[model samples]
Target: MASTHYTPAQLALHWLSAAFIIWALVMGFSVMLLDVTPTFKATIAGVNVSLSILFIPVFAVRTWLRLRHLRDHGHRPGERLAGVIHNVIYAVTALVLVTGVLMMDRPIQVFGWVTLPQPITDPVWDHRFHTLHAGCNGLLGMLVALHVLAVVKHEVVGKPVLRRMWVAR
Candidate 1:
């Protein structure tokens, strides 16, 4: 039989990913929309770049675990749609990360400790990547909203979906 609750590792990773993604989205858009000084904007961008680079490994591990789980346990009845939505979310997240990295026009400096040369040097290509990254982020935001709503809907219908995902005391 399939396990009713997610593993503790899965629970931890889920919350971690949620926190990082939400923070990035909020800070990124705020930097664009608000009248922040150029210096302040650059600071936020630098920090975000570092954080996102750090997050890539975490997301990779999470994706691996998810795939392993699906392979071992498969989906519960009537959960195929949920599985598809989740796959789409993962694909978009990968795109967002890739585009974010590719859009960089300067050397990637991580917390002042490490620096990697920019992957894309052409200004035009960088701008294209930036546009794609923004679009992907928007789609990711919508998907996250839908995910939250689905959880709320399940709860309203007396399903303990959150409880299953929640870390045990």
Candidate 2:
């Protein structure tokens, strides 16, 4: 019989990833599209850059856990499409992270503790990477919306999908 609940580590990673991704998406779009003050925009950019840098390792660990779990447990029945969609989400997330690093026009400062020089120096190439990063990030946002909708649908149909992922008392 298949276990109904995700492991504790899995639950933690999932919630952490969800919160960060949603926050990033909202802040990113707001900074790009809103008429915010330059100072405010810069502050948000600095914080987001630092967070993204720190998140890289967390994402790597999450990916490793996901792959290991899949190998150990295999896929459940009728989950092939969901698996494919999830893989696409992961791939787009990887692109977003890589392009974020590649597009840096300024030094990456992680919460003022560490500073790494920009990865791409050429203006033209850096702009291109930025464009790609924005596109990939948008795709990730859409995929996340779909994932949430699927969970809601499952809940409505009495599957208790959210319960499976919720922290146990």
- Please name the candidate that would achieve the greatest lDDT relative to the true structure: 1
Local error of candidate 1 at residue 141 (angstroms): 0.7
Q: How many residue pairs clash in each candidate at the backbone level?
A: 0, 0
Task: Count clashing residue pairs in model 2.
Answer: 0
The C-alpha TM-scores of every prediction are: 0.95, 0.95
Off by over 4 Å in 2: 1-4
Q: Which sections of candidate 1 miss by over 4 Å?
A: none
Per-residue alpha-carbon lDDT of candidate 2 for residues 1-169, written as tens digits (9 for 90 to 100): 4444567888898899888888888998899999999999999998889889998998998999889888887667777798899889988988998999999998899999999999879999999999999999889989999999998998899987777688874
Model 1 Cα lDDT, one tens digit per residue, 13-125: 99999999999988998999999999999999999999999999999999999999999898887888988999999999999999999999999999998998999999999
lDDT of 1: 0.92
For candidate 1, what's the RMSD? 1.2
Question: What's the residue-level lDDT of 137 in candidate 1?
Answer: 95
lDDT of each: 0.92, 0.88
